[model samples]
Target: MKKDENLKKVAIAAPQLHRHKVKLKIGNWKKHFDFNYVNTIIALALNDFDDKIFFYINGYLITSNNLYLVVQTTEKSAEEMVTKIENQIINLLKTNPQKLKENRSEVSIIADDENLFYAARKPLFKIYPLENDHLIKLITGQKVTLPYFDRDLEHLKNRIRNHPFCSAINYLGGIGPVKVTLFKDQIDPEI
Candidate 1:
């Protein structure tokens, strides 16, 4: 089956996990705390899913749906942060065994602004293996260019129509400059 098809099955067949939504106010220097907290919460909530939680930080919509859980943080002490994150992850593993057996893939992390200072501070840098090498090469191989919003719209439409999995999306009721949309299908429309 196609990747999208398999993911759709996983979404539909996998047991729905309890989700926690946290809104935290932090000073600029403490921004790192936000990533750490979010990761910890996801890890705790989905402990059975092989203790794997995908993270995304200010991620843009893209065709490749494989790397959905990618995040960037501002913590400087990588060694310490990785240990803590891993410990929380272990706690999740001990809590959920069945889900772990079903989903053992690594979590994806997408950094929102490519902030070098923040990137350097992430604990994942010190612990989890990085898998963005190919993506980095693909990006570096291309000539840097400005984004075309119109072109992106077309690409998004094509992806939504041709994706192999069915998707259910939820979005803010009204239209505005910024909107929030949730996807429960193979391809998230509002990603």
Candidate 2:
């Protein structure tokens, strides 16, 4: 596990700027990444347990083959968080056996507390969709947005639409990345 070494390198280069995220590598289940089913199941479970979830960064690959979730809390460790996530996923499978088949996974703590993998890049340039039109600024000067990928909304509308319960997000500034949760309704129908 070179995770500690990688974090050390990142720390020396970008002190105090980091993201606490988990990279879930699931094998043999890429076909289950469907929005109508798989993605929705994950979203609903996370939404149901919202207090523990910090951000829904994205799917690791364009093929929707991996899950990139950002979460931070002093109450739990990386292993604990992964255990909870795995438990949620197992619960999902137990409740809906037809959603997906058997699978294997490897979860790791990929970065600093607030710095997601995206902002971890040397020069960040990806546009994150805010849950709503409302944008925010951290104590440092940076923009943060929680991209809302709604199903029924138009491409443009979906970009602006947020979850019914939450609409607030912070901009990605020198502080790295902030927590942007996925609302139960944020699943993309077209995904």
Candidate 3:
């Protein structure tokens, strides 16, 4: 089989599949762009876990990750697209058992926007762990605190940055967004 064909097959077989929708109020162009760039980086990194990504944008559902990526700019700006993608990726990493080992994972979103003679960029990164006391507190509606680890955060940032897919997205000037929520189970009304 051809290399591209083989990759296609592998992509189809990967796990971590889910669908998501999001809407955001837009204000500043640069801020929005930075947000989107980070979102894209996170999405690219999630592909490292071999998940089949799907996104719903302006009522349109995109299936193929690659195609979804290509069309990300149609409904939203380049930055917005990146942010959505990263949010999805972080959601996946937080939920997928196979990907979540020792209760920790990290993802980074980088935004690169350049003017005629000047360039500016920023990275938004997130770190998740099984022992995320803050997250637990939020979910459980309780108060809790845990020691923060700078080295661990750095390690996670490096892992996502060095990911093969993330590298490509960054090169394309995409930035990821910081995720506020992770995995959620569907509520069944019939229950």
Candidate 4:
């Protein structure tokens, strides 16, 4: 086999996870997201890729009929990745005999970025392991406004900074996540 001139392997320092905002909508407003099925599909899909696909999984939300996930992963064509995961979810829902009565999910990819910041009550971060050693503590601010919060208009950004990346995101609803700077050593210099 000939060596590929375009490819160069880099060691891991910190995983520069891009934020992918995905909303999985059940056709019927009365139905809930098939949690087990969603997990199963994503797990199965990730199994096929040896590269680290996810970095920080901020968490997910279940509105009346939709499941919203805020995921951070290495930037390897995030839209394509989400589409692949969604297709797998659709197949899983269609194949399950028990789920035949339900309609398939409408998975939508909202945004992809490495600089997205998210804030919630200090008491409610139960699902994501924010303290994981692999995750670098970028910023921690208080009182930022997000629809995800109980109130409106008056929100605080914990340790927030203004970065061009903050404005480039097209799908964070109206609420913005805090922006943090990465150290020179964090990103691969050659990349």
Candidate 1 lDDT (Cα, whole model)? 0.30
Which is the leading candidate under TM-score? 2
lDDT at residue 48 of model 3 (Cα atoms): 40
What does candidate 4's lDDT look like per residue over 42-142, in tens digits?
Answer: 44433344344454434333333343344556755545545655554444434442232124755432133111111111111112222321112222111
Candidate 3 ranges with C-alpha deviation above 4 Å: 1-69, 72-74, 99-191
Q: After superposition, how far is residue 55 of candidate 3 from its true place, in Å?
A: 6.0
Writing each residue's lDDT as its tens digit, candidate 2 over 1-191 gives: 66776674434342231233444544433343343455554545554445434434322111133344444344344555455555665555545544232233533332232322222222111223222221112111123345775443344233322322112222221111223433333433222
TM value for model 1: 0.24
lDDT of 1 by residue, 1-191 (tens): 77776664334454333221111221232232334343333335322222243321222112221212222233343343344444554344334322111123443232332342342232322233334332221211211233655575454445533432212111212221111123323242222
Off by over 4 Å in 2: 1-19, 30-36, 50-63, 99-191
- What lDDT is reached at residue 34 by model 3? 35
Query: Mind sharing the TM-score for model 2?
Result: 0.36
TM-score per candidate, chains pooled: 0.24, 0.36, 0.20, 0.33
| Model 1 vs truth, CA RMSD | 19.1
Please give the RMSD of candidate 2 to the true structure.
Answer: 17.1
Pairs in clash, predicted candidate 4: 117-177, 141-158, 141-159, 142-158, 143-155, 143-156, 144-155, 144-156, 145-155
